[model samples]
Target: MSAFFPALTAGADPGRTAVRCGADTLTYEGLARAAGALADRIAGAERVAVWATSGAHTVVAVVAALLAGVPAVPLNPRTGERELAHVLGDSTPSAVLAGPADALPAGLDGVPRIDVDLAPAGAGPVRTVPDAVRTGPGPVLLPAEPDDPEVPALVVYTSGTTGPPKGVVLSRRAVAASLDALAGAWSWTADDVLVHALPLFHVHGLVLGVLGPLRRGGELRHLGAFSVEGVTRELGAGGGTMLFGVPTMYHRLADALAGDPALAGALAGARLLVSGSAALPVHDHERITAATGRTVVERYGMTETLMNTSVLPDSGPRPGTVGVPLAGVGLRLVDDDGSVLGAYDGETVGEVQVRGPNLFSGYLGRPEATAAAFDGDWFRTGDMAVRDPDGAVRLVGRRATDLIKSGGYKIGAGEIENALLDHPGVREAAVTGEPDPDLGERIVAWVVPVDPGSPPTDAELAAHVAESLAPHKRPRVVRHLDALPRNDMGKILKKALPGAG
Candidate 1:
């Protein structure tokens, strides 16, 4: 595939603003020139590490790396010395770019450093008009072969929600395809302005938040971090027509918007409101729609596959289901015997697998794990899903978190959890199988109460569950907590729960 950035830059209006951060705005022409200059400076480097905070400098660094035919590994600006050391050791980048000279990681004695702030514009009569780098006679078009669709382009490390994080390798074609599908699916236009508040390192922000809009020549407003006050201010600033966020972000925004009616007017200008990276609770979805007069389009995706499925237009947003597969993507429900389960029958529940151009090449540098995840190029998603009669995919739960074997009888924890969540008093619930000598394992339920002071007693909850579920499927033990443990994305950390290990 061709370099997407160059193509986008070639087509964009050079005088139009590309990125806006706080009071800073970089025009497309200026951005391309800066990226080209920086690319020329780092032409010889194989790999480069970018450690600057989110802003114009960081964007330039990323574009420069791509232009120079080198892969850039973006580290969280707040990354500590120990974490930086680990990343440096793992990636062995030829150079590091930081905001300040002192921000550089320690112990890299011999590696050459180019202060991004001080990089000079290329010498020669400056071209007045914007031109495609590929078409121009310059060092910017380095000698690089056509990108193999399978070669790793971006190495994004997992968030370690379950265990030790691994770097996921996504190919150029995968990233390009994901961008194309997202633009086409969302109906993105050059007139669209995206209010981006998430960090850039993760897939949600990198591919969807940043590259997706850039590829379509849409403007991006980058916020340093997520905050209700900051988001409200940016939304009110005008020109923000689209919003993307996680569940936690939506909850915070909903609370903020509820207290202030004026905030609703600011958000009313947006055309699309999206929630992903974690499950968007049904209650939260209802609250957001009621407050903003916009439906939160919740989709399911992971780092391995940038995006596999999404809720489409002309469809009523299902509260629990994540809609059907995206265009160019194929979804399958497979049993242990490798039989493809048909979606026509609503009762079928099996492992969700995806085969498509959007799927990643593999996990970086981990052949064994990568090999195990694929069955003839189809990725085993490890998620247990049941498709309804309307073809909407409702996630039952993770296979690792669902099956609870007790006395040789395997029980699905999702069934029990769903039953518990059905209770009006139950706010959030998680079910895990704790070891028991008598039954081999017993079902344990951890619940967050709707009202903290008036949480239902264990006996009451147990009896309530008994009415709807089988005797064996009811929770043997119920533990009330203030809240269920969730990660940065608002996904409940099942592995962290008691007896989950």
Candidate 2:
């Protein structure tokens, strides 16, 4: 196939708007020219580091790097100087791009820096001709011989909550396949204008939100930063047809619309609204639907595999489940002994293993780490899950985040939370294992009460738990919360919980 992006832009009007940043809009043609110029500027660099906030500049810079056959490492703009210095030391990028020169990290003193200017909104005539640097090119060719599908296309670092972030190498074929799979799975078409607000450095934003639309010749309206008011305004402008947001974003939108019916009417034009990156609580889901009259389709994915499963059309999206594997993806659950668990029995819960085109090739520069993540061709997703009779996959929880060994007993916190959610007064619950001096670890329950006035006491919750759970499974400590600390995707930050080790 011809280079994927050029094919999408071919025959299309170059002046058609490709990105909208605040008051500025960059047409497809303008974006291409800027990308080409940026590519030429970094032509001599083997790899380039870009520290940018969400916007057109970051997107174009990334695309330009890919076009120029250089590996682009996009770091969070909020990354601190020490961390940036470490990345600079590791990658030794030939150049760096950021919004402010003074904000640049200490180690990038010799690296060339480029500042991007946001295009003015409807301020000037459309330029038909490509810029000099872009037009001067005879034939743009991929610099690296990426014939080996396993070679790294982009190196994305993890968020590093557990430890220092390590570079994950996503291959060209892998990234392309992910885009294709997502497009096919969602039935995305050129007519679709995706309203994207997620940060570009994240996989969900880069592959699914940006590349997926571009690969399908779809339009993208990028919001610089996610804000309830900004999104409401964008929706009212009549361009966005679909939206993908994290659970926290959904909750915020719901809260905004709940107080204003006009805001809800503005969002009514969207065909679908999706939630991912974390489990979307049932309350939030119901609230969003009540506010916007749109069902928030929740999907499950990770950094290693962009998207493995989803709640799709025709399949009923059960309240607590993440639906089924996406099209062209295969999933198998394996026990601790490596026995492949079949989908026939609904009750079988095991470690989720995935084999799909969307899976990342390997972790960059870490062969042992990459090898440990896979079992032959199937990637060993550390998540624990179960497939029900309806073929829906219910995420039990992450293996690393789930099982707790305490007092000579293995406990599954998800099972406890599931039990607690069934209680009348419990709106939301999260169970975590806390380190104990004598018992090795102890189960702690953090609950959001439906009625704050009559919240369930520790003894009351213990009695309820005792009725349903085994002796060891019952939580010894119970904490009540108005809301749990959650990320943008609404995934609870268990590690950040009070009294958590």
Candidate 3:
């Protein structure tokens, strides 16, 4: 509805802190000047690539791109050379933007590089910023209000867990729609200080974590790197009111809270704590809530969809469910046969389909894939979920990966994983299905036990699952592992697990 972000800075207090990353701080006035100066030089480029590292530079690059009305392509700093090359070839930006020479990651040999130095204003160590960047006039800034909301804002590449990563084209309208809806849904305001130590490459971290605070005229405190000490110190200082993190981050916090009463007391003072990227285990949720007197809310969305559903900020904590659809978002569960689901029974699992202004335009240069992604107007999310009577949605698992048909019964591996996590002896758990002669796909549990010397046996684990859930949902076999492989955002790479046969 309003200009994405740049306009918010115009009439606001100049001294208000807009961002804080590590030791760096950028006031709203400073951010506007930095982004405006950089945007001037690159205004003509249709697209630009940002070395999306977690810090001031990534924030500046993305904001400059938005101010210039050019699409910004965020490249994962940990992206492999092959994946990096594919994104470069597909998006074909005029230049790759990085913070400084040393801050840039490897793998950009052909593209022209542009550096923007965001050293705090009135600094002694400010020679790194080129003369052009310091004095050059910026291109025409985005209108006070959006002249064209449909204009492309970002070209975010997917994780490519299955195939080559595709560029997800997000429009200005979609980005604005999502952030505005979230601000309303969460009751976010300029007075709120958002804190997180998440990576800045994906939607969870960059779009919402970085851009969200900017649009809402709030202060963002980025940890640069996450640590229990950093979280406790920041929250204890009374600087942070809200937190955004993945399940793994919350898991670490939960463990820390168990040991530190001060940390629990600090967290108890925060207004809201939200978790995403993956389902937070019900056990961890209980542990944190018991200690902090606060439950972390979980939200659901994908790269193709900016933000869809979230646990209502006002509602009581419903661990394991991702809550209801956001304003203007349409959500429905569809059967395998494409039939609409009946009333909310809380047990019937079906695929999630959504449609709204928050949906991405399409995958860059992939018409067939884009066409296949949507069922008519609704985007086929491929994620499975069950809705409760009050419209809250509980994520089951991915259809291609996490759904296991065992002995004619459809099973969600997530439920089994939670059941396994509940075992006192189990510290970490992941559930998948392997081929079996008797059952269609036998349930296999991968666990990192609390006491490695005396871990839970397959029979013991199976009995534990059976006692909590149905007898048929027990893990048929158990595999021991030191740790489960996870991506930067804390999602388990189920495909990496062995014994697929």
The lDDT leader among the candidates is 3
Scored by CA lDDT, what does every candidate get?
0.72, 0.72, 0.85
Clashing pairs in model 3, backbone N/Cα/C closer than 3 A? 40-138, 40-139
Best by TM-score: 3
Could you tell me which 10 consecutive residues in candidate 3 have the lowest summed lDDT? Answer: 123-132
* Model 2 per-residue lDDT at 356: 83
lDDT score of model 2? 0.72
Q: lDDT of model 1 at residue 63?
A: 65
Model 1 TM-score, all chains together? 0.85
Q: Candidate 2's residue-wise lDDT over 1-501, tens digit each?
A: 225564324466665667676555666666665565566566656788777567777777776676566788887766777777666676777777665433665556777787643331222222223322333434332232234555456778876666667777777777887777666667778778788688888888877787777667667787877888767777767568888888668767876876877668767777767788876766666777777667777788888887888787445446567878887788888988999877655556788899888788676667888898899999988888778887788776777777677897656676678678767789779988878998998888999998999998888887788787677778889999888886543578888777775
The reply for model 2, stretches above 4 Å from the true place, is: 6-8, 100-102, 117-151, 343-346, 405-429, 435-442, 448-455, 460-474, 481-490
C-alpha-based local distance difference test score of model 1: 0.72
Q: lDDT (0-100) at residue 81 of candidate 3? A: 78
Better of 1 and 3 by TM-score: 3
Any idea what lDDT model 3 has?
A: 0.85
Q: Which pairs clash in model 2?
A: 14-29
